[model samples]
Target: MATDQEPVLGIDLGTTNSACAVVRDGRASVVRRGDDRIIPSVVAAMSDGRWLVGTRAKKRRSVDPVNVIYSSKRLIGRRFGSAEVQEMRQRVPYRIVEGKNEAIMIEAGGKVVSAVEVAAHVLTYLRQMAEEALGRRVRRSVIAVPANFTDSQRSATRIAARLAGLDVIRVINEPTAAALAYGYIEDTDRVIAVYDFGGGTFDVTILQITRNVFEVLATSGEMFLGGDDIDEAILGLMVGAFEQQHGISLRDNPVALERLRAVAEQVKIQLSSQSGAAVHVEEVLPGQRSDLDFSLREADLRPYVDPIVRRTIPVCQDALRCAGLSPHQVDEIVLVGGTTRLPHVRSIVEETFGKKPQTSINPMSVVAVGAAIQGAALMGSLVPMADGGVSAPSAAASAVLLDVVPRSLGVHTLGGYVDFIIERNSAIPLEQTRFFTTTTDNQRFVRIQVCQGEDEVFENNLKLGELVLSGLRDAPRGEVTVAVTFEINADGLLEVRAMDKETGQQQVATMRVLGGLDDQEIEQMATRMASAGPGPSSRGGTVVSR
Candidate 1:
């Protein structure tokens, strides 16, 4: 346990921006780097062999497009050979090359780095900012991730936090964290649906809150969906219009595309509040031969934005159906993520749920605030406040969080069939065991192929890893039996173990999951970062470059 004075920070490490907050005395407030709470999740490679994070890094996107890496979250925990990675390679300006163990590596600032390393840089910046704001050495934290994030993604997130030198106390789902922030202020029990639409991903979660206890009933999402898609759609429109007008294709120019992406993002945000927005770019093409200037009305943009927003409706419906509830039964619909600020998104949410959504809290900071409250409760330092936020540590100390596994867990059985050990939506901090015997006579080892998904074919789902139980006594077929156990902790991390019931010998096979760095890689990167010293230091008070 930490002293009350040494507070634990809560971090919302987002796809586009990140924020941190803390619970002190009896109140919970977001930690500010001066007056700014949201920090862009961007990193740039500098000519001096150092790195630039946040606003500074985002600024270099136009000038050093090839070396500036943004939206690394989409690449984290993904295989280099995956279709998503190939698509990302085409979308971003930076060079993404395949690395060891099918990992995705980025070529930036004349050096090759992993997605985990890039994410670590952003986390380190946030950690430093929090320490400076609190005037204390911040060590422990609770980080939030998308509710439907895979096992590899979760593991990679933990590794990133470790590299940032923060002890991750827990990793909570973003939707669940939002619900916590909303429900912490009140004592009533209710069923709520959390719609978290962020810059790079969309997630819908249905949870039943009984006092302080939050139990997730169902969760569903599309990892490739979010605000970025809308931006890309708008960019597509601009490119087509520009090519038609200028008779030149700007698709091959990385720098120009980067600039256009920035512009497209701005236009999207502008259209949210106004009826129309002007899109203009001077010297958009090389040799100063081409430029673009156009006017886009909200009605024009709706054709692109509407389809993207509507895709979330089915996902929300699926989650509700899985939870055995209807929209009318939900007590509240909480809108989270910066993308929720769009009027069209808000209107669609209301239309889907038949109730007005709650947006009283800053959607960007709500997850971090809830995480901070959870951290304080875990530390036994939380105190009641008059602001209708979380109550005292004594009252919160009894609060329990019951989460669920987002996907199914299974093993490959005879004939390429999937034998599910634990079904999706099963409560967390749970364990289930199944027995297996050798298919052939005199077998000495059993190979266990573990996976996550709802697919019936063993190879169709995401392969988490494999475990091998050896040293088994050679015997006739079906003579030897081993018990394999799959356990998911409260934080939603999975671990597997195998035991030979006949010999009482157990072996825990290493799970070679993707999306995170191994111990050796992490240690080497940490040492390199330490020897390289820190990047250019900028106080949090700086204006947002976006």
Candidate 2:
């Protein structure tokens, strides 16, 4: 082992919960805070203006349903116009509004809060929990992001951590983090796939590992899919039951609907460990004391969620196709995420992959544990970096994180067409160069719109950023040659720049990122949330609301 000195923490911030682990004495251990390894990823504002996180915030949901913010992860780094935002608005009980600077805002306790600020509160809480568990002033950490998160999403996550006062050491993909955690157990030599189905994201990745060399062959995912979708299905069932019993629709009441959804989530968790679970719906209206309890069997639950589970199959097949492998060719299938705990989810994987997935490791903690291992390796405290700096920790100054461009990267071309430069799954920490020319004769400047996605039309794909190469001497169209380079680093975030290679002059252009909320806007909203505090008559029975 090479002697590198420093220590860092690893955090997996999830939609419903957050987990932290640290590498100590050559092993990774889940760091507990107040008797909980998995802290509820909810933040509530109390009447006194203090923020309550984790379990306390979760309890406050029953009383102060309006002020508690859960699952804000879906809104982070997203624009108001995105499909995910549109769908979330219809499904989630919380109010999401377009705020200043196009930031996504959540209405809580009579105050409108930005999604980033809510996330910052969660991050701040996790950081303190880790610090308390580790008994040190933790500053740097490794965070795990979904394999399919876009540039804006990753940037948003980084900003949230920065606001929380922690130095983000690195952002590793979730699948890769799980692979690192597995690789530490036994220096495995084979190709492995990490199938992650979380609360709000689904990612299937193929990785090759041999002699400390870990390479990601392919990755594919749907950002809107996950365990929460399954919960919604069960919630729909509860709604039907309530309608039949009371001869009234609960869906019309947002407060009652939100409470039912929360209880449905708990029932889903219980069903995973037991065969039958009962959910009691108390009188949701004023001066009501009657309760409606319904018991659901596992078989009854399977069909309701089969379609959602089936959606993951095609995504898995697509990932395998991208990796140029059939299901039989994969040596091992590793499961990640809390959703994988469901029996039906496991059965579907077994039927599709033709192999039993390894669940010896807790799917929920694997990502965070793996992240801690990588964090320790990065700090040079556990594993040593390699000399060539091209492979694992034993070989490089920077831990070689070979990430892939999840979607195609391109620039808008003539007639509204998009020309592709880098295809999806291209190894990261990678650089690709493409040449462009002035579209108009005697043009002194060229505008290039950088985009991500596989569509041929510019409008169909995501507009990531833009660049304009100016001050070029007037020349015939197609005469002035400009070289554009797209560089994606280990964190899977993009950086694009242009140069007149012929003149060796750098291009001075600003990038207009579509659907991104800036730091100033996020901070301003956070300040407002802090000042407004929580509302009265919203607290009761160990439930604290802010």
Candidate 3:
């Protein structure tokens, strides 16, 4: 058992909102600053050398669209030329470009910055708020990530935290975090499904809890679909209405469209709380306010957002089938994500699983709270395990987190087939080694392509990173036994190394990140921070507070 005095902080870094909490006296409570349980995950850089976050940063969106940053979570861990990146360009307001080493870049105030820096700015703000609330340096935390995030994506997230001055003890999958937050701590034997539909992403996970062990059976998700998609769908409806009413297409006008989109999002949120809300847009056309008296009954709103909800059904079926179970076998269903708050979401989920979904815990804050619980466990404040899986009697202890490979770990073979070394669902904090020979005579280099996903074809999977071993002496094609080891740490990210077995010589190596920041990009971000005036403390405006 850990000492009772220290607390473990749990953080939920979300696409639309972020929250933090700490476990004290065996009770978990969200750490609140003011009356907000959720701080809008928005950021703004003022011209006067100040930075603003949360509600204040959100205020700048209408007037200063060029300076405000929202929906940045989509860019993290993605390449500048990826399909997602191409789609984001047409959807979001900011400029998306290729930075050094194929890293995604965003332009603001005449400076180019990497996606990680933007994420760090938001995290740093959260850290400061938590430290101020706790009145001490909050050094340890358990952060949550989407269940389907890849190795490079997870690594980029950790790097963002490092830049934000946080020491993340571990990264828990969002659904698992929600399960922990829901008090799945008893030695109850049951299978539970977590339906996570957040702002920008959706994930469904099936877990089996036995003897206090939470084993995730299967996971599936759609990266581009979430509550945000619902908002976009409604925005399209609003735009169509405007175009029909007025002979002008608002889509061609960026500023007006951004404003209307923001309002459309608010209307969608309002529908969740109120049975009917008047959807109103300001000055959609100069001197003409676009006014549509919109009254949405629970029955009416269902059709518009139902398609979005329906997308999750197949994913759920896939997860259950992968776990070798039927819907009848699942004992409990839990909902996680802000979008789940919508009444239709629960009804559809219950109807699908034939069980009342657990709603005692707030979906939005569950992940963060669970992260704190895990954080406390890892900090030796909740459990006695060490960071490296040892035990300690006091504060020197750490918790052992045994995560699984969410997807198979593999390398590209000669004919484009993926050879799996350690398959998916294998116990983590583990290592796998493989040996190979040079393909051609006097081959001075051996190339390794690391990939994630289940597809046999290389193009169908997610290419995470690559490693190349060079400096081999002139020899026959099969002369050298190049031993390569791929190790996945507790964070579920990969690191690779290669060596010559015969000569015991370490080959020159480099991890070719499929979509990662390079030294040049990192330096440019540093310079941009110096030149872009002071960061705003918080942006200065308020919408009807969520």
Using lDDT as the measure, the top candidate is 1
| Candidate 3: residue 88 lDDT (0-100) | 84
Error of 2 at 113 (Å): 4.2
Model 3 segments beyond 4 Å from truth?
1-7, 45-51, 210-213, 232-267, 274-296, 381-401, 440-442, 519-546
Model 3 per-residue lDDT tens digits across residues 1-546: 554445666888888889988877556788877787788888766665455678878878877877777778888998777888899888776677887677887876555567888887777667767776767777677778877788878888887887666788788888778877776656567888999888888889998866555667898888788888888877787777777777568788767766776787787778777776676555666677655433446567789889889988899999999999999999888888889988888888987898889998888898888888787666554443656554442321232445678888889997999998778888788899899798799999988888899899876898877788889888998999888988888888887878898998987777889788766656655555434332332332211110
**How does model 1 fare in lDDT?**
0.82
Instruction: Give candidate 1's error at residue 296 in angstroms.
Output: 7.3
Tell me the TM-score of each prediction against the true structure.
0.85, 0.82, 0.85
Model 1: residues with Cα > 4 Å off, grouped in runs: 1-4, 184-189, 210-213, 229-257, 267-304, 381-398, 440-442, 473-477, 514-516, 539-546
Q: Which 10-residue span in candidate 3 carries the lowest summed lDDT?
A: 537-546
TM-score of 3: 0.85
Give the least accurate 10-residue stretch of model 2, judged by summed lDDT.
Answer: 534-543
Give the count of colliding residue pairs in each prediction: 3, 13, 16
Relative to the unseen true structure, what is the C-alpha lDDT of residue 102 in candidate 2, on a scale of 0 to 100? 60
